[model samples]
Structures are given as structure tokens and as C-alpha cells.
Target: MKESSSFGNLWQAPTARRLAHATSQTSPADSHALGRLIGAAWVVVAYAARGVLRGYLGDSMQSGGGVPFWRCAFGVGMQLGVLPALLAALCASKGGGSPLFPTPRRLERWNEAWLRTPSGVWEWAFGYVFGLFFTFDLLLVPMKTNVLAHHVVCLAFHGWVFFSPQRPGLQLVIAGEAVLEFGTGGSNLSMLLPGSDAVRAFFVLAMSASNTYGAVLTVRWLRLQRGRWVWLTLLPTILGILALRQLHVVNEVYKRAHSPAPP
Candidate 1:
């Protein structure tokens, strides 16, 4: 008790107490309810905005009866929009260590210092991703099982951090995800405009590089935890699945980029 209070005093975080006694004092039920409400709200707003944009863009935006193209556009917009902030946070956290190999202290500060804010970049990004993916998963395009699974896993981990009062490795998960999705916008654009070989090439390079970095970071973080729990092992397994899917996307993009164009 004394140690926790002093720690809280050191950081002066308002939610620190709640974080310390998460299972008891912090009402996860309320957090879950509010999170769902916020996610649903974001989905509603995004769809309305998409509708407005589709109407304004006219036939230029139409593809597969206007579903797939806009879905990609929403993804591209969300991924690129939140990326700058996420990258800035990561760079700030990486300052004290080898940029490629983050040290334990640096990783701790990334979560304790920068990500301590209750409502900021992480929350906003989560809401956007949850809403955008849910909108697509349920309404816009339900047939894409791979995409659906990706969303499910992405949200599962993120949702844990968002709802749980005590977030042990918040920054690592969010930063890794942000980095992994860095090239996804280009991938979406490639799908929307298959003729744009440059975009497809960018997706291939970005996914390859970003996913590689994300995987390494995840491994380092898991090692830092010293095999804390068996469940945490799921991180690498899920990441491998996602990485393979992304690699498949990259391969397809490469093949299409090199293949002959229709006459």
C-alpha cells in the first residue's frame, strides 16, 4: 500500500489508484459498456461521412456497387490519419535506446509516461479502428472472412487494453499495431486502383518492413515479460497468422503489378 501510493505520487496520475486496484475498484463493466457505446457511435458517424463522400465523389468512387472501394477508403483514411500521432509517440519512446531494439526502461516509460493519459491518441485510435472495422465487418462487406478474423483479433487485444484498468504493456501493443498498419492504407489503395503499380509496390515494401518490425518488437516485449503467462503466448501466434495474411496480400500485389494489363 505504501509503495503504491508513493508510485502514484511520483506520477501524479489521476487514474493511478484505479489502475493499481483495477480488479476491485475500477468497474470494468462500466468501461466495457462505455467502450461499446463509443464504438457504435464512431461507426454511425463514419458511415454517414462515407455516404456523404460517396455522393460527392459520384461515379469515380463507385466499385462493387460502391461497398469495397469506400471500405478501403475508410481504412486508408483511418490508418493514415492516426499514424502520425502513433509514430510520434513511438519515436519519443525510442529516444533512449537503439531505435531497432528498445530497452526495458524505455519500454516501461512508453507505457507509464506517454500512454498514461486516459483519453488521448490511443483511445481515439482504438475508437476509429473498432468503429471502422465493425462497420465493414457487419455492414459494408461481410463476405471477407480473412478481414473479419483480422478485425476480431485486433480488437480483442486492443479491447483488453482499453477496458482493463491496469494496462501492463499498452504502448507496445498499440504502437506495434500502428506500425503494422502503416502500409495498409497503401494496400487498400492498391486494391481500389489496381492499375496504380506504384501504390501496389509501396504496399509490398511497407507491409514487409512494418510487419517485420512489429514482429520483432512483439517478441522483445514478450521476452521482457519473462513469459509472464501462458495466455500471452497467443500474441506471437496471432501475429504470425496476421503476418502470413499480409504476406499473401503482398504476393498478390507483386503478381498483379508484374502481370500483363488488360487490353
Candidate 2:
């Protein structure tokens, strides 16, 4: 009887040890998934709040009396609020692991390197082009308020996504914004004036460049895990650019619809 009890205990001990090991391995993965969900939820909420504040401030700006300053203030606020969050998320996602926010050390390193690279020059060029297009929207607002609003929204969202860690999400948002504007009679060329084609081309090129950077990084990380190819990261940018072109065509149609009839 004693021998039988000892044998049973011996058999159950290994099973218990295996169960403990399995649980230990899974806990971090579960925690990581939870963290990502929480982070995404926070982002959605933050954006929603930003939209409401933007509308309110825009109304104030339209009323004159130093209202334009408020618009600039809002722009600065958005940079401060969203950019840091994005950087945090990126840092958190390092180490081939899920992060709740950007790692401080990683962000510092990126900032240092980014400041030193020629890529910084291209980024500045894109920023300037975007700013010029934005100023043009202010002049055209009286002719097509909806189109103006669309451009403002697009520019704001693009800035958020460009600086954020979730580049794919930003690409999708920009593509969707393009579609909305195109549907409403906004023309990329008209918005950017003489350099419209060049502006659009630069955005297209930037999209590809950013996607390539993301894909290469993802591939390197996956290789370390001995995982299969994650092709969607590379494919989405192509689809996004196609969507942008389609949006441009739709915007042209809208413009024609609203134009004065032949005398």
C-alpha cells in the first residue's frame, strides 16, 4: 500500500511540473496581448477627444479676434500630446515583444540617429510641402468648405500617423482620408498648386519608403523567431497608393460637378 502511494505521487509530480512550465511560458504572451489591447483603446479615445476639441477650436477661429492663434495653439497641442505617445508605443514594441508604450532608451537612440541622417532632410522636405498645402487650403476654404475641412483633417491625421509607431494604421487612415476628400471634390493638384504633382509624387514615394522600412524591420524580427514571411506589411502600402490615385480621380469628378455651367 505504501509503495503504491509513493508511485502515484511520483507520477503526478512530473505532470504538475510540466503544467507549471507551460503556464509560465504563456503568461508573458497573454500579458503582452492585454497590454496591446489597452494601448489601442487609449489611442482611439485620445483621437476622439482631439476631434471634438478641434471642431470647437475651429469654430472659435472662424469667429475672428485672434482666433487664428487658437488654431496654431491646437496644432502645437496635438504635436505634444500625440507625438510622445507614439514614441512610447514604438519603444514598448521593441525586443521582439509586445510593449505597452515606447521604450525610453530606444526612443532616445532613434532621436539621436534620426537627427544625424540624410533621411532627416527628406522628412523636413515633406513637412514643408505639407505645410504649404495646408496654407493653400485656408485660401480656398470659401470656395469649398467641405474640401478644406477634408484637407485639414487629412493633414492632421497624417502628421499623427507619420510620427507614431503604428505606421500601418497611419497609412490606412491617410488612404481613407484621401478617399473621403476625393469623393467630396478635393483635388490634390488644385490643393498644392503648381507643385501638386510633385507633392503627390513625394507622398507616394514616402509611403513606399516607410513601408519598406517597416517590412525590413518586421522580417528581421521574424527571422529571429524562425517564423514565416509576414507579407501584408509590404503589400498594404501598394494598395494604399492605388487607393490614393482612385481618390484623386473621384475628387476631380466632384470638382466638375460643382463647377459653373458653360455660359
Number of the top-ranking candidate, with TM-score as the measure? 1
Candidate 1: list runs displaced more than 4 Å.
1-45, 53-67, 86-103, 112-136, 226-232, 261-263
lDDT of 1 by residue, 1-263 (tens): 11122321443234433433441232434544544565566667777867865665433533322335656676677666655443443333232232234456655655564345444332344545544565464665533566666667766766665566645565556667776777676676666776676787787787777777887767765654434563466776768766685767757866776888688
Those runs of model 2 whose alpha carbons end farther than 4 Å from true positions after fitting are 1-85, 88-202, 227-263
Encode model 2's per-residue lDDT on 128-185: one tens digit a residue.
3333435433652232454465556556645654554423322123223322322222
- Alpha-carbon local distance difference test for all models: 0.56, 0.37
Can you give the lDDT of residue 5 in candidate 1? Answer: 28
Q: Give model 1's TM-score versus the native structure.
A: 0.64
Among these predictions, the greatest lDDT belongs to 1
TM-score of each: 0.64, 0.25
Candidate 1, clashing residue pairs? none
Q: Give the TM-score of candidate 2.
A: 0.25
lDDT of 1 at 262: 88
